[model samples]
Target: MNRLNMGRACARAGLSLVAMASLSAWAQSGAERLALAAAAPRLSEVVVTAVRAPQPLTDVLADVTLIDRDQIAQSGAVTIADLLARQPGVELSRSGGPGTATSLFLRGAETRFTAVYIDGVRVDSQSTGGAPWEAIALGQVERIEIVRGPAAAVYGSDAVAGVVQIFTRQGDGPFTPYVGIGAGNRRTGKLEAGFSGKQGALDYSLGLQRDMSRGHDSHPGSNPDRDGYRQTAASGRIGLRLNEAHRVDLTGTYTDMDAQYDGFLPGLDDHGLNRLATLGASWTAQWSPAYSTRLSVSESQQRYEMVPTPPYLSRTRLRNYLLQNQWKEGAHTFTGTLERREDHLVNAPIDQGRHQDGLALGYGYVAGAHTVQLNLRHDRDSEFGGQTTGGVAYGFAFAPGWRATAAAGTAFRVPTLYQRFSEYGQPALLPEKGRNVEIGLHWGQAASRLGVTLYRNRVSNLINFGAPGACLSPFGCFENAGKARLQGLTFMAAHQVAGVNLSASLDLQQPKNLATGTLLARRAQRLLKLAADTRVAQWRLGAEWHLASHRWENAANTSRLGGYGLVNLYASTTVARQWDVLVRVDNVGDRSYQLAQGYPALPRSFFVGLRWTGR
Candidate 1:
């Protein structure tokens, strides 16, 4: 791979200081100050995924994106996949429409390289090492933090690409209730209702939602009949403050989905039943203003049943225990965590189980215009023995609103159950290891923010299913015989001018196999996202556009999926004191596209809904 040179861009960015200085002077003259005052209040924007604890985004050294509740509701997105498609340094591929199998590639890395978390608990499947992105409903999410780069030093494994953490919704302020209903193309319908409240020492939130859609043909040539999907999801949380320095919390989520799909060989009416459930409890205590500790436990289960000939059911369960402590003294902070995770898998074709234990240490220091972070961890897996990872990050502020950051980290991923214990399994396969480095620049003012990041990552000891020499033993077996490299640059910008909101992001990447110099599969070299929103009178109008470059569908670059662009429009307005209406048109141009080689994307569609907010 050719080396990347960013000298010219860096020089131009540095030259912008003159313009910023002039703008600063003009702001001090008065009118700009009033404009800032009239602008909406900014959220604190504290992020926890970067450092494993809450810290202001401005002080973090990693490239991170924050998607808050208001943005979720305003985006007119129904699933996590819809919201993630527009993010920087991310690409998605779905086999079909909603509730189907989906894959997320981060910074040109494979789907399994990323680790997903919900309320500080890992949610990826132990059998496949992939998260059920389709089943994670947006209705239960309060916020999402997407941290790009390696994070195995703080989290254990499968964090080579990045870490995506989701915080569930909880009650705040006085009692409030909400309900919504919507209908769209393809006989799609939705119903949702929720209530939230907080008493003197008790806080709680509950939500229920259901959706059904008669989706278009997944593979037109094979099956012309429409595939259908139905899903029901529920989430709840409760917290009790026993005293001023102690608290207890409980949270849970459940989702069930039934989906119809076409088989690879044109078998129609291929159906699947998917179910997921997660429950967690935590106890927190503050030893003083400077010290705190938390103990938590969580359990999660995932099941999938395929119906038709040769029907089978696969189930995986996980139980986790965690103990964490944090201490703050002057300009320095210290943290320590000990965790144990056990995974149990049951399958008609294969049955297996595994356990892992890990310990981590972290340190952070903030003083004047300098910020530094350090982390180290050691994990012992029942099958892979022990491995260690670590990282360091530093940030320095040259001006009031301008800063530069550099980070480097190492990560690893253990082989999945299917890879180790199945019929074609190779129990001797080793874990995959990765190392990465990145440099970033951030500039932000009143209503404007810009972030730039350049990163390179390399992985070795990668496990693959087909190994010529080794496969001879079992006809096809897993082996660690692959090495890959990913290099990329990400640019993100957001600005609020007058009453309009504008945001854009671009990603350029090179993903290659070191052995053959072939491009990786399903990873686009170029991705662009643009969005604009403005409020006129009492109505809010928004538009979004996304463009992706052609990508290879096969690792050898044999089959390719052409690039495509899509546009969407949204409008919302208040109908009454506590009632609001929303309308959205997706794929406004009705363009034909494909995320996968043979699968077809959704066509132009429209939806409208009414929501009531209780006071």
Candidate 2:
């Protein structure tokens, strides 16, 4: 089937589902619909952390996208970043291979403005205030949910650009077990298996996975790096649908990984290692028809080791524990969450001193079509003081096929210990703050989905360069001396036809210095991204294109990187319900260009994978 016919078929099927849901909601009651999902053999409703609570995407007041496990399995990418790099408004930069330091940017904001989570746990490094995307492999993800635009109000800090959350495997069948082994180019090999079952009244799930890759060709660099990587991970879960009114679930995971890449620092052989562990639990109870309370708690430990200066092994550890609760009544939901993230790091530099942390409190609510969220935090360093951030969004369904949303928010970021205390890296700076507002509209949900949003963000207390030689180093002393402003538009459309999905997104941003009236350094003003996913009978194929505008690297505007385009292709097929094959090609034209100053991107390469899904 081609795209046109496939679209028609999907439209028919989707219309039926929508009608069924709307009619059911009107004929039955909210309680009945909730009960129906459990009795029905097919699951058509999936709630996500996109909203702090269980809400359907179509009913959400914000723009959200979901990439399920089936899609992840076909991408044939090795890392979580690899899979998400194809997202509409996202761009990524990595120091090396999987398990190294990496950054993810959304819209036109820097990595520090984006928040990433795994099962509701903040996984970013407190020492740097950025999640290292390269540290995560995409081997076992169940789903990835992405919400765009400023969301600090509901999610707390680092949400100026939006949020990305990944949900991993929970368990399988009442009692079952399975395993698989595979290999490919780069001397890569994978070993994985898991089993779970019910012991009378108790249920459990345990799984283990390991992967090693000799790696592929590295980017062209002065000091060539031989790409090689290894990852070992294990997770277990136990849950009891104890009774209809109460339930509890507990899950834990541990992962260790290592990788090598071009350090970009002269003559330095870059290498890094990461060890991570997490334990989380969720408990829920119903007190009445319109009242229910859910309690969730999680503890995570993350440590990173890098040989920026060989043999001088250093480590940064993040120990985070959080408790959150939610109470729901009718269309009103209130949430109170307290998160304590204790960060301890030893930079081990001549002028660098050890740094540590305190905690932050976050609270938010969703009542009817209005949402409000806030975060107040205090750090070990007081100059930054107690920082408060939040946002509010009001939305309404104006008519059939039409939804409008208006929102405003403010957010702040304290300078990372790396940016403030690192002897070799500190830029001499204070914290940063920004305020922004946006209005957006959405049209059509099934046959076609289209959205447009306009936003403006203004920043102050920016950490920037002072008079050239005044500072001890040439990098300049950091202070909140200047202001920065950013404005942008995001346009997205999705049309699924005849088993094919055509999705496109375009973003145009202008970031400038309010003081000097010049463009901000190295920020892309225009970015265009598009992707097409198709399934022809048993074979599925996908393609993506990225185009970026020129950008500058400094206030002087002496250095610049030319605009560029990138294209990729992927194809896969299912041999049976239990097995499948994948082939992916990236950088098809092998165009050489800098993704960032002094840093080049990967050249043309291919990846092949074999997968076995659920039994």
Candidate 3:
């Protein structure tokens, strides 16, 4: 069958699956719902990325997902991108195996549109316009918070799509230490160790990890040799409590990776060396019962280089300083922040630096059955003058278990240094701007929940490479010559039936260029994800299914990439009081698929690990 026919069939199948799941969830009796609710554990989870302040998950008015340490250890994912792909309204594309060039699309927006932060420190590449996903070490991450949709009003630039925050482990409770080792197919091996403890008024955490893998062939047509990767990472955190109302924190992380891949020259061995490092310090003081303040300073550096001939090297350094104040009384909350960011890039003949200073204000109210949030920010750029952004959101609960929400926001992203100072650049390029509006309906009864959201985002002054006329290079130049519209409907459901817990999500979206009327490259129009887990005796078993419709390989939509489906299974059990064992099988059917045009995805793989904790 042709790609178009196949795409249609997949869409129909996804719709049918969604309908069946929704009906099954809604068909449960009131008694069953109550029983499920009673059996479920109550968690008072707090999130900080939604409005840049700590708030209960139940009180936030935005779309968000939180992944704790337990989930991360059970996922058996080799990279951060691999783990994020299973999230709702998110997709990933990679050129090869682990540690390869990767891109993450949030809500069908460009990878560069999303902002990334680690331990409250911003991390971005001025040469590429986004975070270096390949260089980041997932093993060092203790938790992750993802906020989907524009957050520029709270975080200045590079938040046109969303924001991702990664947190390292914190010291708490009694002293504890842990060690883990694992091996998998293709000669993959992993070793990790960590310790955390609290002594007197000080707390500290330290961790180290090493991983190596003999990966599969990335480009069979060009390089027939096996591509492999080696990585080493470390993380540390320290905190001191001076008094009951004052505290100071210090955090840092570093990682080095060497990944082999096929370069343009086929006969020679080629490798990509990547390094990432981040450091941050913060001080918090509670001056009054309802007022608090915090001051922080952070820095991050990223370096990338190619070995042997065809030498290439690029480095990016980012520094951030912030002062934040919060005031709270009963159900009313107010926040104000002053932030400054400096960016520096060095790539061969190009060396440039820029700075942005921003002031932001936010207000939140959660009283009775009503919740509201308002944010506004203004940034002054040394190179581009000034820009302003704002957002407003509201939620109302009219029934016992039902809520309706609506939100609107504006965001912008400044042009990357490479787009304005490199060989093929346009110094007059303009920052891309986006306007978004969304509405949602949600129903929850303990462990059982159902939600539907519709969103429309329009972006103007989109930047793309065009025929060279304003640059010295003869090839092409970056220009703001396009417009795009991203509209979508997302459905999510979770329920407990018998002894099994189930969850599902479906996304139907049209991310298209308004100028040529073509779908965005490598973005599927339909996506579906499903998972179920249950406990038997001492074992916990889970299964996941992922499906996506066909996608276009390029902007013209003439080159078609076929649709595919994948299934994965995992099981974990306690061997001894202090020992844990986990086994996972990915791509159970050994299905052949490709996330990019020339790169083949991994085949069926097996992995097992054992961990021991000292209490």
Q: Write the per-residue lDDT of candidate 1 for residues 349-436, one digit (tens) a residue.
A: 6678888899999998878778898999999998888989999988777776667788899999988887777666777888999999
Q: lDDT ranking from best to worst?
A: 3, 1, 2
**In model 1, where do residues sit more than 4 Å from their true spots?**
1-43, 265-267, 467-475
lDDT of 3: 0.86
Q: Candidate 1: worst 10 consecutive residues by lDDT? A: 23-32
RMSD of each predicted structure: 4.5, 8.0, 3.7
The superposed Cα distance between candidate 1 and the true structure at residue 252, in angstroms, equals 0.3
Between prediction 2 and prediction 3, which has the larger lDDT? 3
lDDT of each: 0.80, 0.63, 0.86
What C-alpha root-mean-square deviation, in Å, does candidate 1 show against the real structure? 4.5
TM-score of 1: 0.93
Cα error, candidate 2, residue 588 (Å): 2.6
RMSD of 3: 3.7
- Please tell me which model should have the higher TM-score, number 1 or number 3: 3
Q: Count clashing pairs, candidate 1.
A: 0
Per-residue lDDT over 1-615 for candidate 3, one digit per residue giving the tens place of the 0 to 100 score: 334664575467546654655322212211122223323443346778888878766677888877779888888999888988888888998888888888998889989999999999999998888999999899878898888889999999999989999999999889999999999999999999999989999999999999999999888888788889999999999999999999999999999999988887777778989999999999999999999999999999999998986899999999999999999999999999999999999997889999999999999998877889999999999999899999999888777777788899999999999889999888899999999999887766666677777788898999888888789889988989889888787777777788888878888888888888888899998898888888999999999899998998898999888999999999999999999999999999999888888888888988999999887
